[model samples]
Target: MFVLHIALQGCLRGGEVVFGLTADTGGHIRYLLDLVAASSQDVGVDRIVVATRLFHGAPGPDYAVPEERISDKVELVRLASASPAYRSKEAMHAEVESFARNLVAWIAAQPRPPDLIHAHYADAASVAGLVADRLGIPFVFTAHSLGRVKAAMLGPAAAGCPDLARRIAAEEAALARASLVIASSRDEAEVQYAGYAAYEPGRIRVLPPGSDLARFAAAEPRPQVDAAIDRFLHDPGKPTLLALARPVARKNLGALVRAYGESPELQARANLVLMAGTREDIDALDGDMAGTMREILVLIDCYDLYGRVAYPKTHRPEDVPAIYAHARARGGLFVNPALNEPFGLTLLEASAAGLPLVATDSGGPNDIVETCGNGLLVDPRAPEAIAAACLRILDEPGLYAACVAGGARAAAAYDWDRHAARYHTLLRALLAPEPPLATPRQLLVCDIDNTLVGCAAALGIFRRWRSRQAGLAFGVATGRSFHSAMAILEQQESPRPQVMITSVGSEIHHLDANGVTYTADAAWRARVSADWDRDGVRAALADLDGLVPQGSLEQRGHKLSYFGDAATAQAVRARLVRAGRRANVIHSHGRYLDVLPVAASKGTAVDHVRARYGLPERAVFVAGDSGNDVEMLRAQGHAIIVANYSDDLASQAGLTHSYVARASHARGIIEGVGHFRRMLADAG
Candidate 1:
């Protein structure tokens, strides 16, 4: 379909995320998803599409896994059972080619394709990258885990040999085509993506996924916070400390819990609050909550001071801010002791929530804590430092107040609205306006009745005439059907008009030689249909004796032209016009009284004829000599009114420039056409 985008109609204000999902699939996709989701929240993204397999951990419709829910604006497409696994070598290549073709078709079908595609991981990157190039669109890629970086970080999974080498090569190809490359952390970019010297440095921007501070500040406070802490802490008014992390070895929650057990102030009165197990509702990848809970229980038992610690596992995301707020009210401190943490969203969450944070100095927390002034930074590997920082937050009121004030000020600056606006700006910069597909505006209308062909005389000359004159473009606008009108056009002795407006006022057609067709409105023709005489005196003629239907509109174009000598045809016209009640009947063929529209006459017909030939509007000539010819005579003011015409018509026709034709009928028509052509050539 050829469609026109008339500027002002196509622009959007957000970016969209398209991703794949499954359970044990929290590889680089998770990192990309986290950043994008956070980025989207910070920026007001309008929509997201998640391409899902049959289930979380399965690949077909028959899988038993339950439906997965994400955001309200996100749509999920179930991948068919025929979909190939990403881990398969030969399958990956084939899938990329097939998916890219389908993806392009989908994009083209959209009302507007995305401005910039940001696909995560190598497989998705290559797929989107291929389309971006073909469609002349921009693409941004974020390689969270590259082979080299993975090899260094996760070891065996990163080694490039055979299948792994091929996978890494795909990542390299996609990155080379990326308009922009984003890295979660500088380390990942340097260790994973930087090895390619050809990668443009200016195109790579390091953007950490930012968190929303407003939501954190307004978060539903933990209602049970006071109750839980009161039942645990000895000195109720003294400051307390909070702990948060996943139950994994790298998270180092065990060290923090042990320190909380030994801290002097914590042991004396302050309560130790640990996120024992999140009521996050997100099913674990392993699906072993019982086993997970038992491990945390053992850690608590080892401390033996379990009475001073509180396990709040029924925590909802909504309660996060209140938890932070309650901790702030109680002068609580946030502690993170992860070993070699890449980037911790929890730390940013705590800072945004206005809780004075305490995190290890080695990784992302190093940037967050210091940049925001929301917390005390210490090396997590040093237990003494972790223990000491915990005691100061609990015991030093002056130092604790400064941290609280800093967190609040820092939280105020990280507005999600601002983040969304910047991302929106980047997307706009990335997109180009779609190519124009509409033609320039202009109108072409032609006469169908008398000019192109009236009965066989006019239509018969059409084909031979069109083939003779090539420069004059043709358009037929007549009160004729698409079926009959086209047949008449086809039978013409000339090439067909490119545009055919048939059924008169009903439809306008654009006919191309390529078998392409388009239909629209012939604006003027439609107006004529409503106002003109449709069931005219012509229809009534059927009831009259000797009056028969003739013209294309049945007794239209040729009118009731008298067949006998000129005097009789003239006498018949006088009788018809004399009976006029509203206006006098008109006759161009002499014997015919064409009850036409007030403005309609052969002059109108001639005007339409010149339009059909696209001659200058002022250019016209006629050869009829009766009342119907009065309009044409006046229109052509200096036209020939056949000598056989009555003196009454000659006077009304303003005979100033009249020519007494020595002949009439077809011979007069031939003379009129020849004279008009001569006048046009002379002017040229």
Candidate 2:
């Protein structure tokens, strides 16, 4: 149906480039435009509207209208804020409350309000979250870059950018408030978003932003574009090293300059072409740009490289593909040396144009290199590493040829049409309301930790409430061992659950008044232990560098537990699988890893319990907070993710028939119980 997208601070549309530029008018703007353009082509999408903050006299001349039509199906609506024409996102951030209020007023006046709101970046998310709450519509967020991750990368320099703290707060609020968050890459979902407590891996869907292949497809370099390159090169025949991006401090342009200048082989073999945005005078640039420019200039002079490096004065968007083509024709290299790139859209463009790439080894480049199989990733902070990667591409003929071929082959998969279709599918599911079931026969299984025990009082309240309820049975599905689960139940003075799914679904136990006791499902246990070689698996993981064995109480016979981060967990999983053990590995909360039999999982254990009780499938409810709980959350039964669950769980994909509560612990249980009751009531 109808979708409202918010990109608060940017220059709104492609045509509005006539408006004086700001830091916000970059990749994000291009991303939204391409998304809307692609979605507009789909017959299923009724209308698409992009809402942005209106600007006045400061950045450029104020526009005459509040709305501008981009296409028959897509339109732009500019909502006026407290102040007009703020230059940067930092200024807009200060007035988000007013902007949100103004947007709400505008939406209230619409003949029919949009079905959903998708906010881009943290600033827009703050406004969208506020407005969406007020309007009772689902709010989605796409954090182009996260503040916590950026602050971590920037370190002490981050303090000088005073807005970082506020940005991190806004991001937390956004993550908590949004129905979903769109991540650009799996690394972004697993790494960048992992640090936030509210970040849910399930709620985050990684849909890489697509490149406009028609515009970026391989092409012959135009005469003017060729002349632009030839102007600085002593020999036009020499292969070139191309670097393109705005002159932002994080782009690490200075590092690239030094990288090329430090090595005699790189300097003598390939000319360095820096396209650091259109500039008439370097002295006229603002603070951030000016500082970066000074760094580049200092490096050039320090290395005594004058004519060897070409810093272009200006280039238009239409000239980009040809620029890549120019580099390709010369059999040159394309480099993106950003300190922390969110997603390298230009790498896609360069790949489509068949230019081999050498990018920084952080964020999106990791995915790009792995997927495209075309590039070498180097540490942007290390000049020698940068030089060495360039040399590898330049000096090795076989590697160069492979990179060129691989890039051409990989470029086709990042299609805008495919991305739009998937986006539409998710939105449509949210839009279509589910009919009420006949009764609340469904069983709701829940996880502990952040999911069920965040606030002590709420948990106590839920425990007292659960003890009194007789309509439904309950189960505990957690990564905790049976002993650990019993400790919490006993401490809380809570009623014993009918079933306990422990060790992250590796062990199943039935509970009663006597105490927690192991109750094996013979068939399920047989399936789990069929090919399991506990000793063999242990031996395989013994030499794994990062995996440290957990304490005795935390381990189980069927489940091998270890403490490790995301990368280590991945390595452990790979190693176990390669050793041919009949085990499945799960990494949860970014730290814990578990290896269980292929047939054993939280979902399967819950299913076994439901069958034992002879409960209808619809009557089953399962929940958890971290990565370990995702399989159960995605299972056929109704599910509840209690508020305060780890973000990794929320951002997980493919969750249906699940409810994420606003209240933490038992309050969350109470909230979910009420939701199910309402569903039953509506059916009657």
Best by lDDT: 2
Q: How many clashes show up per model?
A: 16, 25
Measured on C-alpha atoms, candidate 2 has an lDDT of 0.77
Estimate the TM-score of every prediction: 0.47, 0.68
Compared with the true structure, what per-residue lDDT tens digits does model 2 show for residues 199-299?
A: 65445666777877666664779989988878876777778899988887878898899888889988999889998876667776543777787888889
Off by over 4 Å in 2: 16-20, 62-65, 159-161, 433-684
Per-residue lDDT of model 1, residues 1-684, tens digit only: 111100000010112211112212222333444444554453345555543223222233333222233555443333322353322322344456566675677668767765567666566677777777788666667654454443444457545445456667777787677766665443343333556644543345444555556677665546576665566645556555777654544456667766766565556746677764444443432223344445556766876766667766555445556777666677677888866455566666776666777887645565466556777877776777888887766567777667767767655444334444444444554543222112312122344434444446544453455445424344554544343454344333333455554432234455432222223334434433444443443343334444333322223221222223345444434444453322223434434434444334445544554564456643444455455445556665436655456536666626666555555533444455456567657889
lDDT values, one for every candidate:
0.50, 0.77
Residue 395 lDDT (model 1): 66
Worst 10 residues of 2 by lDDT: 433-442
Q: Give model 1's TM-score versus the native structure.
A: 0.47
> How large an RMSD does model 1 have?
30.9
